[model samples]
Target chain A: MVDQPLAVAARSLFYRKKRHRDLRQRFIEVLLFLAALSSVLTTIAIMVLLVTESLPLFEKVSIIEFITGRDWAPLFDPPRYGILPLICGTFVTSMVALFVAIPMGTIAAMYLSEFAAPKLREVAKPVLEILAGIPTVVYGYFALLFVTPVLQMLYSPFGEKLSEWLPDIFPYELEGFNMLGPGIVMGIMITPTISSISEDAMRAVPVELREGSYATGATRFQTAWKVVFPAAISGIIASYILGISRAVGETMIVAVAAGLQPTLTLNPLRPAATITTYIVQVSLGDTPHGTIGYQTIFAAGLTLVLLTLFFNVIGYFLSRRFRETY
Target chain B: MQGSLAGVRGNIQRRQLWSAIFAIVGLLVLFIAIIVLLALILQLAIQGVPRLSWAFFTSFPSSKAEEAGILSALVGTALVMLVTAFTAIPIGIASGIYLEEYARKNWIAALIEINVTNLAGVPSIVYGLLAMGLFKSALQLGESVLTAGLTLALLILPVVIVTTREALRAIPSGLREAAYALGASKWQMVWDHILPYASGSILTGIIIGLSRAIGETAPLITIGALTFISFLPPSPFKSDFPFLSFDWVRSPFTVMPIQMFNWVSRPEPEFQLNAAAAGVILVALTLLMNGLAIYLRYRFRKGVKW
Candidate 1:
């Protein structure tokens, strides 16, 4: 009977300790759950902040005018609130960036994933990563000081000569703060992003597929371009979308190099204000709260968010689809 | 048969020539990217190296370009990073742990995953707007160090969480099974086994995230970081009782990039030199951090067998 009581007491003590551990486990789990939830909360917070702040501005100015109007002057008497010019600037620069990035990024990805020796790949990968790691602000500095001067020098004479032949298209010369310099620099900034992701997608293709192509007596380039590229098309497209989203959302490069004049021009040689540059210009000034000037940023922000969100969602889904396919 | 063989040989030769051309083109593109990086560093060094001096580190902004220093900006960046590191590290690690360990394959986990991926794609400037509305206006934090720190923390949270989860996932499953076999609870298994094994990689992720955060000028600019601040915030130390103080977090700040921006935008050529000098320091700091992270990752990868 004494042995039975001792056994029961020891068992009860063990159970109590286990119970305490269980309670602590639950508490810690809950804390972690809340931590994970915070990201969703941040998304919610951003949405709520943008919508609530933008509603007041929308009430004063119609959404159609904000999206479709060509003028963006909100500080002057009878201030206009058209955002089309900013959109045009964003589009032109991003298009220029894409023109440079796509070919360079794709070729680089092909070389890295298909042709480069393992030793060379190891060295090159980190160098590319370092390119991505360099600050956009430095790129901005390069765009304004170095790239612009070079472009102006190269284009000044060329534009002059070309205008003699085609006055309509080549009338304007490259300005000090034109879209081309920042656009080209932004292309350089975004190349690593596109190449790295596309390389990953290419690398994920089955090795047997490459071997099969080689067995057919195909050259490395032929196999890479015909087989691997097609196989990784979805992922490559995803990278392009992501790169486009990044270029659209890029701020400092345009703000520092591309002038803040909101001109609706397709000319890469002209200076214009992008949506991001406009936001930066306005934010740099002291526009009092609740005023149309201050709220304009929120309106601009909402547009930026929606535009990026559209691309990001597509890119995310396409990337996920690619992962599933392979 | 001889003619057909000749045609086949010619076709193969053409294919080989095209392949050779593409290989050279690809190599050229790769070199161009590398050359761009080298050129940036070279340009910054040539322009900024002459401006680096003992006086440059201790002085504040002045009307004369030669008289200005980065003391206030440096202090501001350090304090803001301090705040960002403390706030981001714990929360990011915890969230990563939760998603990797505890969460079931359900809607909540799916939602959080999607949110993180999308947030990573959101532009940095938008984060600044969020901070302006939520922190500066709604919470009345104004344009203070705390507000800037919090904004960056939110911005980098997704990076940290993604890296932590990746590190945790890389730990061999045998370790988890062994812990469970030892009658350890789930939390104990993670704490005792998974985390220690993944610490090196997690730390590397933290450094990289911080390095990116350090170079960020857009979000801070959007949050209304000052272009010129002649004085430093209150120090976080005191000689009296309770020697620690957080009064500095509420103080207005100007970071290195913002200072560089202010100088870069100036009309004078002298200010451009000052901006270039600041750029050198900023780039050096970011490169140092990223280099350290890369080295740590390489070392840990080589050291850990499993």
Candidate 2:
């Protein structure tokens, strides 16, 4: 009878410990789940904040006019809210940036993944990372101070001669704060992003493919371009899309170097304002809590978010879809 | 037969020439990119070196460019980073753990993954806008160090999460199996085995995230950080019983990038020099952090083998 009582007491003690451990485990899991949920909450908060703030602006200005209008002077008398000018500026800068980035990034990826020796690759990778790590504000300074001066010095004389020859086409002089400088700097900034991603994709291509091409007497360049490039095209495309998204959303370079005027022009020689630049311009001023001037930034923000979201979604899918199993 | 042989030789020669040309072209392109980077750093150093003295670091901003300093801005950056490190570390690591260790492979997990990816692509300026509405207006936090820190914390949360998950994922499944074989609970297994192994990598990610946050300008500007703050936030240390105070978090602040932006925007060459000096400091700090992270990662990798 004494042995039975001791056995029962030990069993009860074991059960209690197990229950206690389970409770603690459950509590920790709940805390971790809440931590995970914070990201979703942040996303929801962003959407809600943008939408709610933008709704009142929409009530004041029709969505059609907001989208299709050519004027964007929201602070002037009878404020104009057309976003086309900002969009055009963003388009021009991004186009210029892409023109530089796509070719350079692809070539760099080819060199790094296929051609460079291991030691060279190691050195080159960090160089690219340093380029990537430089702050946009520093780039802004470089764009404004160095690149612009060089462009002006080189292009001014030639531009004057060309404009005299073809008055209708060539600009007389590249302005001090033209889009080209910032665009070029932005291109340099984005090169690492594209090259690194595309390099990863190229490296993922099976070595057998390279060997097969070499066996047929293909050179390294030929093998890389013809075989590996096509195989990694999806990832390369995804990188380009991401680059475009970055260029579209870039702020400090355009804000500091590209002039604040929102002129709806396609010429790279002219200074203009992008969506991001305009937001910074307004924010720098003490525009009060609830005004059309203030609300315009949110509208622009919504447009920016949508534009990047579109490219990001496409990129996300393209990368997932074309990821090679081998 | 002679003619056919000659044609084949020409073809081979042309192909070889093209290959040689491409190899040179690729090398040249890489050289140009590196040259540009070197030129940027060189330009900053040449202009800013003379301006980087003790007085520049210790004094406050002045109407005269020669006398202006970055004391308040540096202090603000430190305080804001303090808040950011505290808030982001625990939450980001916990979320990463949940995703990698606990969550079932279901819709919710997939949604979180996609959301994180999308969040990474959202423009930094948009995050600023979010802070303006949610933090400054809705929550009425004002343009304080606390708000800026939280804003940056959110900005880097995705990066931290991704890196944490990557670190955790790199731990071999054999370890997990061994822990479970020992009758360890899921939390016990993660807390004991997985975390210690992954701590170095997680730390590297945190440092990198902080570096990125430090150089950020657009988001901070959008949240309305001042271009000129002549005063510092309240001391984080108190002479009272508790000995620590958070009043600094709610104080107005400025950061290195903003100060640099302010000086760069000025029309005077003197102000531009100040801007360059600030740029040199900011870039140096960022490079230092990244270097430390790289060293930690290399050391950790060398120590661990599956």
DockQ top scorer: 1
Q: Candidate 1's residue-wise lDDT over B105-131, tens digit each?
A: 999999999899889989999999899
Model 1's number of clashes is 0
| Deviation from native of the Cα of residue A50 in model 1, angstroms | 0.6
The collision pairs in model 1 are none
TM-score of each: 0.97, 0.97
Off by over 4 Å in 1: A157-169, A316-326, B1-3
Error of 1 at B154 (Å): 0.5
Residue-wise C-alpha lDDT for candidate 2, range A180-256, written one tens digit per residue: 99999999999999999999989999999999999998888899999999889888988999899999999999998
Q: What is the interface RMSD of candidate 1, in Å?
A: 0.8
In model 2, which regions exceed 4 Å deviation? A157-169, A317-325, B1-3
DockQ metric for all predictions: 0.83, 0.80
